[model samples]
Target: MRIAVTGGTGFVGQALVSALLARGDEVWIISRKTAQDRTGQERLHYATWQQLEQNPALLEGTDCIVNLAGESINQRWSAKAKARILNSRTDAAARIAKLVGALRQKPATVVNASGISIYGTSDTKTFDESSPAHINDFLGSVVEQWEESARTIPAERLVLVRVSLVLGNRGGAFPLMSLPYRLFGGGRVGSGRQWMPWIHIEDMTRVLLFCIDNRDIAGPVNACAPQPVTTDQFGRAIGKAMRRPHWFPVPAFLLRTLLGEMSSLLLQGQRVLPAKLQQGGFDFRYPTIESAMENLVGKSSKPSV
Candidate 1:
């Protein structure tokens, strides 16, 4: 299969690209980098957004296009940072939509990244793909706009992967998250009751592929494990996996002071279920928080996160 990916250099995108290339698939990376066509014995290619704007035919034969390009929301949520977060996501989706609209041969499928935050934070509520989006906070609002833009993409099948916290030892949040445990400081953050819907990086990649291959799957699909854990249980599992004590309790006020509005992501969260994935018979390799942490931490002495 020939696939085009935006943000192919990012953490998740790099992993996804590697997986695709391993299976002998042709991969076109659409980025801000210089354009490069397929070289001899190379299935990977590159095309800049500027080049694509000039010639939409660059990605004409691509079988699928995955839109994962967006500004990282990992920074301090300043006014400017917030604007970047929202605009970057919406802009990326709009660009993909425009590119698809200009395409002489539209891709069979488009897998756009969405967020579980669109369901809003909840202490006593469970959400699924069937649940309506609730824009209750900054992240929620950003994702709402993000998905709205993604909806405009011209594809036969559009799968909006409502990604949750993707946990991996080498990338994403797992490395830093496990740092405290490695230092024997694993503890509760904020109120510790916030729901944490997570999926292993491997499972995340599979979910994306499943969405692409499955003709019956469309619309919003939560890319999360069936067994979602609370923040407190999450820390405990990490501590146990690392042979550290989960005793320290970071106060909510400290997190609020330190992270400002961004702290709400840690202090409050929604319990999400991968209902669509489950109904479609998608099997998760790491179904539980315990299993996910063990696989992420138990491999190396000091794994690079």
Candidate 2:
């Protein structure tokens, strides 16, 4: 299969590209900046998003297109950052959809990345693909527009993966969380009761491939692990993995003072379930938080603190 990936240089995109290459697929990466041959691999190619838009011929033989372009939402939601977050996604989606529409031989599938933040801050309810979107907040509104932009692509299979917090060895949310633990400043956030829906990066990439291969799976799918851990539990798991004591809680006010609106992501969360993925018989490689943390940190010689 020949696949074109936007944001292919990003954390998730890099993993996805490697997974595709391992399967002997030709991968083309769309990015704003130019890359140098990707460790000198011939199969990997890079092009600016502008070049892709101008040269619609690039989509002629593309098998699938995965759009993962977006600004990091973890930073302070300054007005400029918020606009970049929204435009980066919607603009890329629109570009892809336009290319797909104009393609002489359109790709069979399009997988656009969404986020569980689209569900907003939920206490008890577990959201699935069928759950109504909470578009009132900034993150929710951005995702809502992101998905809406992708829907314009008239592909045979349009998959919108509402991804949760991605836990991985290299990047995404894990390392940042592990930092405090590594320095022995680890602790829970706020009341530590907010549910943090997450999936191992391995699982996330596999699920994307699964969606591409399985024709029956379409529409919105929750790309999250079955087990949903609270912020406190997550903090404890990380601390334990690093053999550090999980004491002291960061007050919500302090977080708000520091991170501002971005603090909401830490202070509030959703209990999201990968309803569609589970129903599709996709088995998780790391189902439980404990098991996932163990794999991430490797076998700890000492007992967890």
Candidate 3:
């Protein structure tokens, strides 16, 4: 299979690219500059976004297109930062959609990455693939527009994976969340009641590949674990994994003052369930917070932790 990927150098994209290559799929990575270390790889190819923009034919014969290109959402959302965030995602989707439309034989599938933030902040609401809730916040708005841009991509199958907080080694949200735990300052954020839906990175990658292979899977598939935990529960799991005490508490006001609107990323969440993936017969390797933390952070040798 010949697959083209945008944002192929990012944390999740890197893993996805490697997984695709390991399975003998030829990969065309769209980036500003080709990775020097991957220079001599046989099945790996690279093209700048500019090159693809001038010549959409560069992606002809591509079997799948995985779009993950976007600016980082990890920092304070300054006016400029927020604009970049929105433009980055929607622009990539629009460009890819245009390219796919110009093709004589479009890709069979287009797997786009999204977030579960579309469900908004809800403690009482349990959202699945069928939920029609619309979140009115910054992150939520970004997700809504992101998916809309993806709708333009013409493919037999279009999979929009609504990702939760991804837990993994040296990637995703684990490193930042685990840092305080390692320093013995592990604490619950806000009221500790906000739902924390998360998934192991391995499972995340598997789900993406599952969508690629399973022709019937389409639309939004929640890429989260079966069991969702609260903020306090997540903190406890992190503490347990690092053999530390989860005793500190970071006030919501402090986060608001520090991060402003960006604090919503930490203060709000959804109780999302992967109902579609489960019904599709996909099994999660790390289904619980305990299991996920242990697998990613090395199980605490001392069970008492």
Candidate 4:
């Protein structure tokens, strides 16, 4: 299969691309970097975002297109930074949608990335794909518009994957979150009561591939583990796994002052469920925080994959 991926060099994208290459699929990466041989995977190719936009026909015969391009929301949310965050995501999806429209042989599937933040931060609510977007906050509004930009993609199956907090040894949120724990400064953020929806990196890649292979799986799917945990619970799990103390609770105001609006990424929480994926009979390798933390923190949590 020939696949085109935007943000193919990113954490999630790299994992997904590696998995695809391992399965002998031809991968075309859309990025700013020049093409190079990766692990002798001669089938791997790279093209700039401009290259694809200028020549949409380049994606002509692609079997699938996965868009994971976006600005990182881990820093201070300045006016400029917020604009970059919104534009990076919306523009990437819009560009891909345009490319899909221009292609003579459009891809069979187009998986556009989103986030569980669409449901907003809720301590009392458990969200799934069926929940409505909470357009009240920054991240929520961003996700709403980001997915909206891909509404015009002309694919047989258009998948909107609302990803959650990805836990892994290599990359994603676990390292940063676990750092304090390892250093004996770990504790709950805010009230530590916010629900955290997370998935193992392995499961994250697997779900992307699952969407590509399963014809019946279309529309919005929550890419999270079945068992979600509270922020306090996660910290304690990490503390135990790392043999550290999870006692310090960072004041929410301090985080707000430090990160500005971006603090929501850390302080806010959501209990998201992989309802569609589970109902479709997908099994998760690490379904609970205990299992995920055990694997990621057991052996120093070094970058793997």
Number of the top lDDT candidate? 1
**Scored by Cα lDDT, where does model 1 land?**
0.89
- lDDT of candidate 2 over 1-305, digit per residue (tens): 99999988888998899899889998899888767783777788888867777887976899899999999887789999999999999998998888898899999999999888888787787888888988658889999999999999989999999998898867777778878877878898999989999998888889989988888899999999999999999988877766787987789999999999988888889999888898999999889888878778746523221
What's the TM-score of every candidate structure? 0.96, 0.95, 0.95, 0.96
lDDT of 3 by residue, 163-199 (tens): 8988776566678888888898989899999999998
What RMSD does model 3 have?
2.8
Error of 2 at 255 (Å): 0.3
Candidate 3 structure, TM-score to reference: 0.95
Task: State the lDDT at 187 in candidate 4.
Answer: 92
What residue pairs are clashing in model 2? Answer: none
- List model 4 lDDT by residue over 113-163, tens digit each: 988888988889888888888866998889989988988777888999999
Q: What overall lDDT, based on C-alpha atoms, would model 4 receive against the true structure?
A: 0.87
How badly does each model clash, as a count of residue pairs? 1, 0, 0, 0
Error of 2 at 289 (Å): 0.8
Query: What is the C-alpha RMSD, rounded to one decimal, of candidate 2?
Result: 2.7
Clashing pairs in 1: 170-305
> How should the candidates be ordered by lDDT, best one leading?
1, 3, 4, 2
* lDDT agreement with native, every candidate: 0.89, 0.86, 0.87, 0.87
